[model samples]
Target: MSRIAFTPTRVAVLGAAVLLTAGAAGVAVASGEDVTHPGKRIGTQDAAHPAPAAKDAAAAKAKPREAAALTGSAKLFRKTTEDITFTFDAHLAARHNADPSKATGTFKFVHLEKPGGKGGWATGRIDCLLTGGKVASATGIITKTNIKEMNGSRVGFSVHDQGKKDRLGYSWAAVGGPDGTKKLTKCNSAAPFEQVKKGTGDFHVQPWKLPYPDPR
Candidate 1:
């Protein structure tokens, strides 16, 4: 019996065949394009690319909602004839000396002139009760006027407190307008409140709520 020795050419051929088979298998796995399985493809379904419009729509949905428009009645009052002032009590004093105390004091929205040269005017008085008091008293014709957005309206006005001079400030948006069912919404002061002069001791009454009607 003759023994046959393996030649380098034969060894190279065998190695090449093994490598070709392995390379083909590796490419199929890496490409992830299995024609046999139509459902399978490159990358992943869950990680699929998003359309430009779809991305934009998603961003729009995430954005904050636009605020409601002001009421017709609220649109009437465009000016004030007198100076508007906000009195602060101990609570307000502690908050920033300018913060109108939800605790005690009075917020008077007085002499609010009508819009469109109507010449009609109104007033509002919000009475702050003692600490822990429920439903403080409010009065005056302006009281009926919506200073907030809904029942309230956001109006640009000035604050004439002691510490802060006449500085422009805006009231919170009320729910309904003056004619709306939800009347007299709360109007919290924004900004410039921090600039108000700090007060101490018992609550004090200050002459605020001056109005200057807008010229028609």
Candidate 2:
């Protein structure tokens, strides 16, 4: 048996590379965005697995609570905004599921940003919490990850600004399931994130933003 050699001419190389990337179905990887890990431990942990009925009830109760106090731009963007397809460094500081304790990790996303001039904006998606509610993943666009799981495992994140000013904003993942009902719990119902400005735009290379084939 002979192994096939893979070589290509430069002309269609870029096009072929794109096609190959597209064919790889969004298989995820770690991101490197946040440089000096920021943020505080704002998560909790739990050993008991609450029933779906209870979880739903908790989500219902927590929704209003989060809304009532709205901290960052998460609230406004969550409704009127949609994630743009781009690359960015996403910093994450997670906590325990049973106790919602603080943990960290670097994540990469085919990030999505809200439409319109985001005063400078960025958006990213991650698997975050696992089914057992034990693992929380944070994949970034490029570079390396600074992800530190609740168990103390850590990864670095690499990211860059696409020349947009809005500082890298942060939000919380409320619930993500098989159903389309997955929602991102805003870090601040009022301002989920601080809108970055133009002189503050950023971007990266390694973890390129996935192409989200949808209308703006």
Candidate 3:
């Protein structure tokens, strides 16, 4: 057997050829374009690391917020008759971030006595829009008037249906003064009716100390 002699130049050439072939194969595998599978389709490999889920984007667009609750009581007194006091209690709820002057809820009046001894408790629903914590317009009913007719013909009158025209109803508007007062223009007028806060209860919650007992 004839012995072959090793040369540096020959060895370098051979090494370079091998490196080129290996580099080409590596490129083919990386790019998924191997010459051996020329006709066959090759699926591209995904990234080394997967991208994170986009849950934050979905969380950003949330549902609308709920309305807020406002519960409080006010002393409704008339400027003309300050001595004759009437306790006005309100249990109202407001929409989200709504103006405090605008609220809708229940209102109760206790000991609303007239100078002629014709007075009674009034319980009704109030839909009031206010301006600067002053009443803009308040419309409600005098559900029951414990006062009797002057002729003593009827002991008391009860509002059977709120929708009925015959039912006693009242409407009020703010009378712009230092005191938060409103003027009753419908169903027994009382001018310069002041509203003073007594206390506050939970917001957006109802049925708190309403439908009070007869004070007579």
All candidates: CA RMSD (Å): 27.8, 24.3, 29.1
TM-score of each candidate structure, all chains considered together = 0.23, 0.17, 0.28
User: lDDT score of model 3?
Assistant: 0.35
Kindly list the per-residue Cα lDDT of model 3 for residues 75-155, writing each as its tens digit.
Answer: 333455432233233323434224332344544544434454554454554443222122222334444445322111111
| Superposed model 1: Cα runs more than 4 Å off | 1-102, 110-122, 125-142, 145-164, 172-187, 192-216
Best-performing candidate as measured by TM-score: 3
lDDT of 1 by residue, 26-127 (tens): 776777874445557744444465655678999999864311111001111123442222332212223332323243322333222332332222333332
Give lDDT for model 2.
0.29
Q: Look at candidate 3 and tell me the lDDT of residue 35.
A: 54
Q: What TM-score quantifies how close candidate 3 is to the native fold?
A: 0.28
Residue 22 lDDT in model 2? 58
Best by lDDT: 3
Give model 1 RMSD, 1 decimal: 27.8
Model 2, 36-119: lDDT tens digits are 233322122234865456899988886521101001111112344554332322322222332211222233323234544333
lDDT of 1 at 53: 62
The lowest-lDDT stretch of 10 consecutive residues in candidate 3 is 154-163
